[model samples]
Target: MVSPVAVPGGAVLGSAFAWGHGVNLRRLKYFVKIVDIGSLTQAAEVLFIAQPALSQQLATLEGEVRQQLLVRTKRGVTPTEAGKVLYRHAQIILRQCEQARVDMEAAGEGLSGQVSVGLAPGTAASALSLPLLRTVRARHPGILLYLNENYGTTLSELIMNGRMDLAVLYGDKAIHGLSFLPLLKEPLFLVGPRAMPAPAQPVKLADLRDIELFLPRPYNVVRKLVDAAFVRAGMVPRVVAEIESAFTLTAAIADGLGATILPASMAREVVAACGAWQFQIVDPVIEAPLALCQSDHLPLSEPAQAVKSILLELVVDLAGTFAATPEPELAALS
Candidate 1:
């Protein structure tokens, strides 16, 4: 067992020695905690250690690196470029080492585990969710998935709260204490009653000024991007209704109620409906970027990592297919 005393460099414990000594896992843990919370005192409280001790360990690490890793700000201590770099490398090394240990013990055991997954409402059923489910089912039959879907804000909160193991979202800002890896950029589309006619190709924002629209409530990531384009065109959107369900919204559009601007993922069945139609939202074209977010404290288990890898593979496949065929060609199919 590694004794507490075996941990080198107190406070910022691992920061003292230069390139040549035994690895100090405890000190590295301290440095990572400080970086995550952005303050030595907060990091101390969380780690159940004293502030002075944390400070001393950090100071010692600075000595070894021969550079300040963080700078005191009014809000908290922000990462110095050096500190940021170290934090990244430390995280990678820590995760790799942990994975190595697990692999050594397991010797490639069968995948039989449970991972609770989350999906933001917007990304829940799209490429992120669908392809991932297929791959998981085929490759890791023994793995059980506990899945839930919700709005982006709520999903991010769930990951932070440990209510979820992982979440697929389309984030505009980096959530604190979680790691987000962008997977794909899903296109934006203008959906209307199937009878509603759009041009053979993409339509301009200014031209849609008189059209009535139904969409998810304002303030959502996609809505904001849509609003910005309308603002630039000096037009106010004529809102017909606010809806959450793409299925319901599609039904409404197909019934000739009103049109909607939505992610390509949401517009799928709606596009195929006889009465409803779809077109690309262009000029300043915008796409929602799908992301995978995981808790820093709860490093991804092997099963969770398998899901992530499958998600990325699908994203890569989509990218390659899109690159070979331009949007102009695909939108014409509708």
Candidate 2:
């Protein structure tokens, strides 16, 4: 048999399989390595096995499982739906095996492993990220923790794509092949430059008709909510700029470009970074629900499960404080 060519990541697995036969650990390891490296030839070289031999093993495994685990193309390989399912299970199995070994080696020591989590910018700003990291670092000194901050939509995509083990997302937007645990409901706030006087009272979404605003694209969860409210209020949102970066949005607002809507906690952070700003509760009392989300198909490793538990406890503690106060103290914010 000829050596299979190099395949890039995301190459589609074009075949189907009947899930009947059991897969061996050796086959699983080979399959996972190929999926991770995105190239059969590269995985074979790394495994110190002949390309043809590796290919034969993969073919045999596929035959036993009766599934096409990967789609091969000139550019690279992509996992099919079935392949993705197998890849997730395989990852958990492999990780558990490694973690078992590590635990054995560190028997008397402490838990030692790696956990990577993604967080949306708002969730990160809600006074969760730093505390989570600090607590994990302090308590599980041996556990390696990685944090990736991005938009809620992006974070969900990362979690689904297997790039992130888990993420805190907004609105519980239904994402396919994922599970969610509701965390908290955060009240929304309108943030504007410090130079702008505080609104006399809580501003209504309808009141924003004439105001210039800087917001993320419509696809963004926050923006989508804001847009829906505007539509409900029969107001035409006067968006002056479409900025995807949270940092850029804050900078623009500070420069007096326009105001934006965000969770009260996140708005406070923006005000602190961008200069003086008015943080007003929306009249209709808009609230964004956040949740801890994970892939339904991907099993959480022990370390990841530990981190998730820690995160849940921390969010409960913090959210309780926010819940006690409908509106954060505006005076103290300034």
Error of 2 at 17 (Å): 8.1
Angstrom error of the Cα, residue 182, model 1: value is 1.6
* Top candidate by lDDT: 2
Q: Write the per-residue lDDT of candidate 2 for residues 1-334, one digit (tens) a residue.
A: 2112112254433233322344566888999999989998899989999999989988887786677879999977878877877786666566667767876886878777888787777643347788998999988888889888877777777677655777877757666667877666777788888776656565777677777888778887777878877777777789888887767877888788778877766777788897856555557777777778898776776678889878876775666555523122221222
Whole-model lDDT for model 1 versus the true structure? 0.69
Which runs of model 2 end up more than 4 angstroms from their true locations?
1-22, 80-85, 103-109, 124-126, 157-165, 173-176, 195-198, 295-302, 320-334
Off by over 4 Å in 1: 1-108, 128-130, 199-201, 319-334
Provide the overall lDDT of each model, using Cα atoms, as 2-decimal numbers: 0.69, 0.73
How high is the lDDT of residue 7 in model 2? 23
lDDT of 1 by residue, 1-334 (tens): 3222111123342344454553366777899899999988889999999999999888877776677988988899988866766776566556556655655665577665666777777552344566677789999886677777788778777676555667777764665668876655667777777566774465777767888988677867787777877888788888878888867876788788878887776676567764566777676676776667887656677777877666556656654442212133223322
- Distance from true location, Cα of 317 in model 1, Å: 2.6
